[model samples]
Target: MEALTLYQLNRRIAELVTNSSTQNVWVTAELSDVAVRGGHCYMELLQKDPDTGATVAKARAAIWANVFSRLRSDFYIATGQDFATGLKVMVRASVSMHPVYGMSLVINAVNPEYTMGDLLRRRKEMLARLKAEGILDMNRSLCWNEPPLRIAIVSAEGAAGYGDFMNQLNGNQLGLRFTTRLFPAIMQGERTAQSV
Candidate 1:
């Protein structure tokens, strides 16, 4: 048997990676983590098993500063939303391997409308499922009563929305009174869905 050092193995892998795939291959996955450092955008992409809710695969991906800037703007223009965590995006990327970074995808393009369509389909499916289960009309199903004066707030404490809401409610000129308490939570990015 022959032995190879880490550098030798990585070099071989990098070579294999370079020759194995073509540029501009479209891939779809959920963004697990996203960060920007020194103008470069880096992210972790994850694919999950829908039925079992388990992660199927994960990959490191990057968008160069220049490419990220244009893609982010274009995505926002198409979707009216930020390109942040928890989005399932379709990206055109070149598969690459490095001696230090292992395998990664170099992203060059994004299809924001793909995710928008996916989200819309999921929402419609959820609504249909809820309706078929006789639970879709939750507000109408519940017994009627006047809305409660007391409210429990759940949001990140420093969020502008929270500040504005508190100010509007507390400083109402009509002098409407209510009891309110805020439960602070991470309001954005990957943690927000779990926070809520």
Candidate 2:
């Protein structure tokens, strides 16, 4: 077998990936890590086995600045929720391989309505199953304040939402002071459980 330079091998792989799959594909994955920088949103996507809860696959994904704004706005409009970690999402992405980065997905669009439906169905199913098992809302027995004053915001450092929240806090008209601080977060994957 002929030994090729690392770059040559990766370049050939990239070419193969590029040629074999050129169309946008819909994929379902859990966001393991998420970050936004210079208007671009980057994500780590993971697929876990349902029976064993073991992660079976993972990939690096990115939504460039151009596609991210429109996709995010549309998602909020359709789903009435901000895209965040711990949510399963169906995104339309194109697969690619990079010499330095290896295999990954480049997301250009997302079906927000589809994701919203998935979330709603999952919530309803969970509630029903829990109620059937007679364990639903077991936490209701705990005494807790109606509105928690201490709110900790965890997000990517340069995320737009974090910036907006800081601005809103600074511009609060009411004198009601709340102790709040943003704890930096890796919003996409398993690392978050360790950090926050």
Candidate 1 lDDT, tens digit per residue, 1-196?
9899998999998877776355679899988778788888899988988899688999999999989889888887787656667778999999888888798999999988898997799789989999999888987867846656799999867655688799989898878787998898865455787888
Which candidate has the top score in TM-score?
1
Stretches of candidate 1 off by over 4 Å are: 20-22, 125-193
Model 2 lowest lDDT segment of ten: 186-195
Clashes of each: 0, 5
Q: What TM-score does candidate 1 reach?
A: 0.70
Residue by residue across 61-137, what tens digits does model 2's lDDT show? 99999989998899878876566776688998898888888888999988786778877998899899999998887
